[model samples]
Target: MGAGMGMASDQQWLQLALTGLMVALLPLSYAWVKGRRDRYRQLVWLTLFLTFDLILFGGFTRLTDSGLGCPDWPGCYGTANPFLAHANIHAAEALMPSGPVTWAKAWIEMIHRYLAMMVGVLIIALMGLAWFKRRELRQSPWPATALFILVCVQGAFGAWTVTLKLQPVIVTLHLLLGLTLLGSLAWLAARSQPAASHDAAANRLSPWIALGIVLLAVQIALGGWVSTNYAVLACTDFPLCNGQLIPTMDFRHGFTLWRALGKTASGALLSHDALVAIHWTHRVFAVVVIAYLSWLGLRARRSLTLTRPALILLALIALQFASGLSNILLQWPLPIAVAHNGGAAALLVTLVFMLTRSGPDTNQKV
Candidate 1:
């Protein structure tokens, strides 16, 4: 065990560097576009697009139980790609054919890492471009810089998710961090586009917009906890949990917030009641979020600048509600579960975009 782990540690850096080099090339080529005056804007939007896909793919990773496929951080058996780890993977699979470390699962895990690295590269490109052309870009580069830092923090959580064996807190935080990155990119992108109006009335809505963001963020975290702990199927029913309105719940354990994966801090496997608590909390919180956001969406529709995102918000909420229901009634189909995650991401981005538009566009000309 010691020798094998030592060898893995030795190869880890080289493999990671190779993976970074390979993934960086694509975004670097895109950013290398010659003489495009508005390339910064282009980069922002493109980064936003990639970040959105990354978040959705992350959900796919978690939902398919592929998080542990590679069973290592940043590589499969200390190799950059699963193909190179074929012997190790095959041996492991041969030992336990129906286990998590299958060929397909390894590929899914590596693809997620590759895509994550690609997104990180794009964020770096965005930060570099913003700084290099700060004067010409006419916008503060702080947001881009902040996003770069957030992605780094996210990368740490990604490592922790694997290192900690998908501990509930680490995995859920990983998901939340990814969504935060998406919202940050969306907010930054809005600055580059022309605002419909930056009038005083629109500015007045900033506080409420920020509040909505906070509420939605808490709601997303609750949802993430449910996903990470595999609690979505806890109730397996809509409007009622386990055929009862409240049911027996163990919030103390469910919301313990720092326990190991599938086990409590006391090293006991989590109980059904604990899972019910998590699922119930997320469901109850959704109602509050939906009601408040609906009102906000209505208020936003009155402002032309906010109208598009307001409409998008309503659509996303409907998608989210329906998808959440589908997961329960349809036995948690992969596509619908992934859609629920994506819908939550879209809702976040739309609201952040609206907030960006309503608030002062610092770079806007007189």
Candidate 2:
């Protein structure tokens, strides 16, 4: 069996850790040199920037069908990298030329892991600095500590994404956790550099902002479900699906959470109707999300303190709408699909950043 069919050994885990540490060095060095006033804050922002990139690259990995490129967790076929696992990868590729395992895909998958591990290492450094410099930093270490725990949980789901054979639920959760990590990091970065503002008018919108976050999260989850299940092309037509307003759908089977990929709860091959259901649900729910977010953006744009972020929010929402339509009309082109995912992340970060600045109880000073 190639690396895809075998399990990662103990030694391989050590090699992966070392590889992650090596990848982390550059970013760590940058934060150290540039962080004169607040190294912790610099690292936090750097980590956030890299985390966003990781999420985009992750989108590439998935869209390219490279999730199973290694077919094993933490390492490529029980080796540290694709180069070391050539024999196994070659064997698998030879067996099935067009299968999930291939040289290019193996590289893509391993690179994703490498980037994820790099992010993990940065988070660890962040938590360490948070604890050691809490007094000087004037920030709670607990948030960093919580971020640390969340990343571990995310790593676990990532392993499951591979080990469980790209099961839809596991993969979707992995995507969601990654975005959640990004949003959390944005919150930290905002806290690190506070903008002194107490706009009661803007602050009044905090509750609605909170609601927007919740709605966006649900939309993201729905989108993740569509992507993980490979249902993006189920209804290729844009405003209407399959040239019909309400096509036949298998909602129960489509939304069955615990089933394996491309299969129903009882292991039957998933029907086209089920895929339609998944895709259609995401498409319909998007109207509500888009409308609500656009309204929120317009509402927030009136406030001087929030105008910039509000503009960013509206711009990203437009990008999302355009990219999302292109995904369907363009037949799920890789670049547009990836941009759609990134747009969602950007929107979340924008909303969270705004929320952090505007607290509901704060009164306007100006």
Candidate 3:
């Protein structure tokens, strides 16, 4: 019996190793494509695209109650692939047909894990390339190393997201960290190429642009908090909470980041007022962010270099605002909610790219 058990463990290990390798094919293909074109610059762009997809799919996984579908990290139910967990998932589904741990949910969760591992592999390859081509590249190995560290930290948060039962703080931090990674990657990609030499003139609204970026980031954080806490529907009204301009709110509990997922510090279930507070705060802050970003975009439209990005920013801002309102008026429809999240990420990427290009090519002088 002991020998049989040992053999089974060995087989399981082999299966997981194989799955990890199989998931690496996409990045490997990307590397091959980059090698053929000698366009390492475009590789960064491709990675950015994949990162955005990962973020969206991650939202899908969370929204679908698939976060705990597999109920394990780096593997599904002690196996590397969902096939191995088929029986376990099937059994769970049989027992609780309408509950969270269905086979479909497990598959979704495992697929997400696989995609995440692929992104990690891609980042690893990127760092290696950065180091190999450090002489030719303007950016140093330090940023790549920092990115690697960020991904690792993000992975830890991902693990805690499950282990802690999707505690609001951990999950929200995970989202913020992912966005940070995207922004950093965008900055690196912008720095990798020789800046366009024709337009060396400084953006006159650099200070305002910087301020807009900062404010947008803060609003994203608050939005993440609101989503993680499941406060989207806390306030059903458009301009007010419960038909009042200033409805009753528990800002203390709403802003308390250290509490449990659905409970206050004293361990009681959090009040509806707290949820109202969280949601309303995000709603009110949106007005400030939207106004500033719109103004920034309009200000930037004067410069040819920033005109396209500014317009894109303005369009996305409008789309996000509409989608956000639709969520309240339409009862949080999944499609609109997902689009809203994607729009926020898209806006961030656009802003980052614009900011990176808005400045002069200082490295050319170096």
Candidate 4:
């Protein structure tokens, strides 16, 4: 709700970029020195790793109620970091001690931004390297190029996440885009390596994997919806919601995507039934996801190349179930909630990695 772009000075933006560049140098240096061949691929995988971290940290920022810690995009109180904006943060906190802005929360939010920018810089490097090495590189440069654009769009959504006052739709889309970027990077990383031996079974399972991805994407969206709306505790019990199999729910209001956070489109306060609807839908749909993905993982295990990732997928499914339960049973512990988010990303990465290798060798070329 703060005047996002109008509040931040140009100097703050420059400083933010500088900090990101500094953070990116660590991975750049590592890739440069550690890689003897296919450094591009090395950087891609590195970017993927950091991106996974960024997503988890983003979840942390949200879970801790730090989304509005700085209240404006790309800077804290028109400054690059929390230290420079301490007076403002302190004033806001002092005025409302339980409110969104606090020194610690500001740092958490700003640090999340800094990591995001670092990932952006690395992706820029990837786009540049891919284009520069297009002739000799094993994989196509276009996907890397597309990744750069995707990161920019993700950054936009990141800004909107704050500026739009953490609207559920915007936040959910932001989460989805982050996962999409992770999955794309996973595929690119897989392509940068030598093609594995073709598994007819894995190839045959491609359509099923595609179906699983659709279901997984839907489940993740539902999860994001629940998280953004803070509806996880709407159903504290495992098998029942509000001690009933079918609790009263306001599906119309709950599924209204464009409304403000905790409010309906008409600006009335969101109802308990709406929250229950959000949480319950996610809970019920999760069963379909678990069953389908479990079957997919088991089916994938029959493939020689996909067996390991398939096992990892099954493990992640179990982790999701456990962490998800912990969120409800433990009243949404920070570590468990964040791990639940990270587990989703890991599942997507593993699944996409499997999909990348599932194709025929002829189509495997970058």
Candidate 5:
């Protein structure tokens, strides 16, 4: 809306349409593979799997500081593919050499966009097929239609995440929206699959299990804040923060919800104390998430149907704990850090799977 940002470029519009057609072929191929018996269900499961992979790759893009590799939203340098934008990308890299706009980073950024578009195309096909087979499948296509709409919203935030120059709040919201979409697809897949038999005891604890999910979601938001602000190394130690149990923290500015990328609301540079506050809050919340989710796991494990997801929850929390500790002790190795992001996503989907199976809507065989 600003004078500088202006309207979309002519090249950008044409390139985006070409990119859409390219990614559309992916779903067409996918449907052909699962042409027999409840193929829509197979499509749902496959899309959910790809979405999880996209989230992890998105983490790779962020952690490598390649968010602005192309310096544009959907396309790289006004072109859909890096190969076509080679001249523009090389010029930018030559100007900044070791900066954000490099050839490798451009490839990374463009590939991420391509995968996102592929996921969107698959979701659209899901809506189409679900409606076409509604008579035989005896299921409404509304859920797939809803997913297609959600992917559009997610794509908008993805554009903002780049165009806004990775503003901390905007970037964090973009990551959250991706995870939410992943969970929605997982729930959709679970709905299509036949429900496993659930015993009486597991049915009784659905409310408490739901409560645990909410708590985990809050912890994830705190983790996102710590990440988007680049405050992970504020403490440089696990159990203790900066050699004190409760270091001096600037909660006032640290938790100011609406601020720019690396500055406070008043445009002052973010302070070390504020960074400590954000990091410490995430650290403290992790303990609570681990304990409460484990307890929920124990209760749900008494029933055969809920046992596997509960066990998965326990494993993911353990992985999260180890990876978080490694980030501090090892000075944030890329592999461990990316794994930590995947751990959170796995935990979220596992919970969604459990909830779908336990609810009354999933009690009957497909």
Candidate 6:
């Protein structure tokens, strides 16, 4: 009996060691790829690629209704992967065929989790690279460290989003955090590359471009709030919500961020009017953001590099507007609705890239 217990302990220790090794492998692999190129610019670009993929995968996870698929955190059924939880998932599905907890949903959710972990790994590798090359690379590692910290916080929010049963505030924050991460990575990438000699003309317009980025970020946050609360089709009419320029709205209830997922401050189920309020507020903000960004894009058309990104931003803005309208007119078809979300993300990335690129690089200061 004593020998058997000792053997069991050894096996358990070995299993944990293997798990740690596997987790470590992800960062190692990323570093290996990132180290091959002497140019920090290429490394930054690789991070951007992974970040973009992460945003898209995040959307896919949300659209598939897989947010709460695992019904647990860090793992599915306390296991690292879905395969181990197959029996439990199948049982849950058998019990509720059309319920939130389905095998497919579990797989999707777990896959998202794995992808998120990989991103975290990449960020860690990025920070490590910055640290290792701090002597040669003029860029600071502080930003990379901050990004890694942000992703960790985002991961915590993601877990809460599941454990708390998809709380609206938490979900909205998760979305916003993802975009913030993307923007930060874009800034890092822009800084890594050698900027064309300081153009006084571009420097003159820097403040306005920065303001545009700030406004766009605020608008994106509002949009995230609207999406989190499932208020996209609240009005279902263009130019006016519910056919009125100023539709009846319960601003208090709609903007209450700390309440239950679908409940009001009074503990009553959220009303349609509350959703309309939420959606309408976002719509109004969207108009302001669109007009400002369009003007900025047009103004920046003279710069060769800035021109293409500006045009892409304009095109995505149009696509987002149309997709949003379709969601209302077509009763929120899933494909168009998802595309609308994707378009918002694309617009955010494009604007971030444009603003970063448009800035005069004062390498003299750093």
lDDT, residue 76, model 6: 75
lDDT of 2 by residue, 17-70 (tens): 999999999999999999977899899999999999999999999999999999
Which of candidates 1 and 6 reaches a greater TM-score? 1
Residues 1-366, candidate 3, lDDT per residue (tens digit)? 999867867877676656656787766786677666544566677777888988898888877778889877667776777787889889989999977689889888888877777778778877787789778764567787788899989989999988887888898899999998988888777676666544443355666777887998889889888888889999887776789999899999888988888899889999999999999888999999999999888878877777888899999999999999999999888888888889989988888877777775524522
Candidate 2 TM-score, C-alpha based? 0.96
- Residue-pair clashes per candidate, as listed? 0, 1, 0, 0, 0, 0
Best by TM-score: 4
lDDT of each: 0.86, 0.92, 0.81, 0.91, 0.85, 0.78
lDDT at 148 for candidate 6? Answer: 93
Off by over 4 Å in 4: 1-8
Looking at candidate 1, the ten consecutive residues that score lowest on lDDT are: 357-366
lDDT of 4 at 51: 93
Off by over 4 Å in 5: 1-11, 23-28, 364-366
Candidate 4's residue-wise lDDT over 235-311, tens digit each? 98988998999999999999999999999999999999999999999999999999999999998898898899999
* Candidate 6 local lDDT, 1-366, one digit each (tens): 999856755664454345544654754566467757664555567767777777777777776778878898767775666787789888988998987789889988877776677677667777887898888776577988999999989988998999888888999899888988888888777666566565555566678788888888888788788878888888978988889999999889999999887899678999999999999989998899989988887877766657778788778878988988898899888788778777877777777777666676645312
Tens digit of lDDT per residue, candidate 5, span 42-99?
A: 8888889989999999999999988999898678876667888899988988998989
lDDT of candidate 4 at residue 222, scale 0 to 100:
97
Indicate the worst ten consecutive residues by lDDT in candidate 4.
1-10
Residue pairs with backbone atoms closer than 3 Å in model 4 (clashes): none
- Candidates sorted by lDDT, descending order? 2, 4, 1, 5, 3, 6
Runs of candidate 1 exceeding 4 Å displacement: 1-12, 361-366
Clashing pairs in 5: none
Q: Clashes in candidate 5: how many?
A: 0
